[model samples]
Target chain A: MRVLGIDPGLTRCGLGVVDGRPGRAGMVAVGVIRTPSDRDTGERLLYLEDNLTTWVRRFEPDVVAIERVFADVNVASVMTTAHATAIALLVAAKAGVPVAFHTPTEVKAAVTGDGRAGKAQVTQMVTSILKLTEQPRPADAADALALAICHTWRGGTEIRYAAAAARAGGPR
Target chain B: MRVLGIDPGLTRCGLGVVDGRPGRAGMVAVGVIRTPSDRDTGERLLYLEDNLTTWVRRFEPDVVAIERVFADVNVASVMTTAHATAIALLVAAKAGVPVAFHTPTEVKAAVTGDGRAGKAQVTQMVTSILKLTEQPRPADAADALALAICHTWRGGTEIRYAAAAARAGGPR
Candidate 1:
């Protein structure tokens, strides 16, 4: 299965693509989507949507993995984040691709053998797992890879009714 | 002064534009940015960035207003929410527009004279204040307008430290 992983952020988002077969694993693409700081928030979000839509169409990965929201404060912030996630989910559904969501702890545990792994640890493991010559830049990119890896290890185990889930939910 | 308010989200973002003048009340232009629900979190963000950039170019507002995040216990959800706000901030910074943030409560208070105003109350006030012929569609758009109104009122009292704050924060 070809899997795409995403580390979500407003300013920076890390994305990684891996081709996983029954016993063979390979890397496809890994990079970050950055929103310039001087644009309007609405424009930034549209940027994310535009770039991601293009990426999905170009890569056509079988599945997409995303990190789950981990906290509850900043109600305004939460709403925005949810919007971001909702956009991602919407894209995947549009492409007829399945999506898997993993918690930060689960991604850390899978990537670094600890649920509490630090950013550095997660980055290190992601680089090593992909056998890259250098560590991924901006940390978020590697984290995206880790989320993808976690999904590869646990794909299709969790069933999601995304469209139904979204309709019922108020916030993004 | 022209203040642009944004209610950032993954699926739909609320955008409100208010024209502020010395010794005169402002007016509002409110709308929502809607993205398909099938996109993944990353692509959704990219969409947000692109559209928001377009909005800025078209409107050329003097200032931007955004809601601060409200935290929650669901870590997976919180991360996505944070990303949305972060991306929005990045867009404002890139555009060289001054940005201000407000809490939901603060926005409610400014719009409805009650910090605990319901969504309907806030929406009604937004319509009345803007002298709109109809209620803004999709609550996000109205909320974005309210944030803009709040920021206009609050930002007026704020020391205009655009250069210093920009340099200190850089582009998000």
Candidate 2:
């Protein structure tokens, strides 16, 4: 399965696409969409929407995985992050692609085997797992790749279990 | 001037439209767009987008006024509210309508001359100002109308000031 992972932010939104399932994955693309601080919020959001729509149309990923925003994180940025996330979710839904959210800890644990892993460690693991020649430039880019990897490994199991439940006439 | 006020929320998004300038205003439309809690977040947001797009098209307001979201309010709901707010902003921008944000205190003060006025007082003032025979039902609906009224009264001054600045070759 191919997954598009997003680390949503108004100033800089990181996007990474990976093709894989379970234990193996390969990076398809990694980049960031940046909006100028000088622009009004509405314009910036419009820019994000346009770029995200382009991403979805270009890659045609099977699923979109986004990093979940929590209210407790940096009160000032949380609202903006949530706003950007909403745009991403809307784009994915409009494209009819399934979307999943992975918490920071879940993503770290999935890639590094430790929920408390440091940034460098997570980046290092992502590079090794994807067999990349170099580390993803910005921390946001690495985080997004980690999210895709996590969803591929973890979400794969969940999808299988859901399918099994459906076969047995159980709750989905 | 015609103004569309949106009190953004995932479950019950309140929308109000008013036509008039500073002191005098008439209610053109007032209602809420609701989404079921059972629907997934993406689907619900899509529903909001559809309804809000319809509102913008049908009303053709000169300005779209939305309630500003703060991170401090009801931690569980703030993120969702911010998400909804983003969709409103996106819709306004896409339609080329100018967007403005008003804090709760600002709306209250504009309507009731008290920034900390209670909801009932604000609702009563809205009902009186529009010369409506009946108070707008649902606190959300009343709050939305109050926002529209506030924008009609307050935003007018800002718009005039901006125009004056432009005429004077001053910064806008």
Report the Cα RMSD per candidate: 8.6, 1.9
Q: For residues B84-161, could you state the per-residue lDDT of candidate 1 as single tens digits?
A: 666667677678887788889999998788999999999999888777888887899889888887876776655345
Q: Model 1 segments beyond 4 Å from truth?
A: A1-20, A24-66, A72-100, A104-172, B38-47, B73-83, B131-138, B159-172
Q: Candidate 2: DockQ?
A: 0.81
Residue-wise C-alpha lDDT for candidate 1, range A97-130, written one tens digit per residue: 7788899999899878899999999988878877
Top-TM-score candidate index: 2
Error of 1 at A18 (Å): 5.8
- For model 2, how big is the CA root-mean-square deviation? 1.9
Give Cα distance to truth, residue B155, candidate 1, Å.
1.6
